[model samples]
Target: MLHAFLAAAIPNPGPEAPPGLGDLTNTILAWIKWGCLVSGVAGLMICGGMMILGRRNRNQLAIEGVSSTVWVFGGLALVATAAGLVSVVV
Candidate 1:
């Protein structure tokens, strides 16, 4: 994807644009694409971790530890899903 964009991005240097000039918009778009890719991967990992964590015995562990782990891991998974969706949209 980046390769195709870069291929076409070769500037037509003239009075308007200097030699070797490239579009800033493409740079910004590339950053956004990279960020979204990272977000999706991170979300996937979080969901995987959540599955492992959900299988663990919470109550059988300790009162405080169980409660906190449940809330934290659950919340993290939710946030990860949301981020992944947002990345897809943007």
Candidate 2:
């Protein structure tokens, strides 16, 4: 049949990774993970500072700081689960 001929014409080479590419990718991923952690911590600290400064009178800053905490935590959660998520999808 035409379907069989077409299937035969197309060869399926599943998942070919170049040599050393995996190692390079892993190194990059590690760097990114560390960067994410550092940034997340810095973001939390900045948010805390904002809340403290705003507590005196500027309620808006305090509210903004509180809301920003959620975003920081969300980013941390995503970073923490990134590997697992990739594995699940792949």
Candidate 3:
């Protein structure tokens, strides 16, 4: 059948890092992940300060701070689940 023939034409070897670059790739990924964590924490702290400072008269700043908080959390969530998501897709 055409379906079987097509399937046989393609190979699925699963995901893999290049032979010599695995260690370097892993190290880079780890560094990126660490940076994400550090930035997320810093973002939260900055947002907190914004909210506190804007609570007095800068209502617009407070709103902006709250809005950005959601984005920061969303980014953190994505980073946290990236590995699992990649596995599921691959």
Candidate number with greatest lDDT: 3
Rank order (by TM-score, best first): 3, 2, 1
Model 1 Cα RMSD, 1 decimal: 13.1
Scored by CA lDDT, what does every candidate get? 0.59, 0.92, 0.94
Best by TM-score: 3
**Which pairs clash inside model 1?**
none
RMSD of 3: 1.8
- My TM-score estimates for the predictions, one after another, are 0.39, 0.78, 0.85
Clashes of each: 0, 0, 0
Off by over 4 Å in 1: 1-22, 58-90
**lDDT measured at residue 90 in model 3 versus the true structure, 0 to 100:** 80
Residue 52, model 2: lDDT of 91
Considering lDDT, which of the candidate structures 2 and 3 is the better prediction for this target?
Answer: 3
- As for candidate 2, its clashing pairs are none
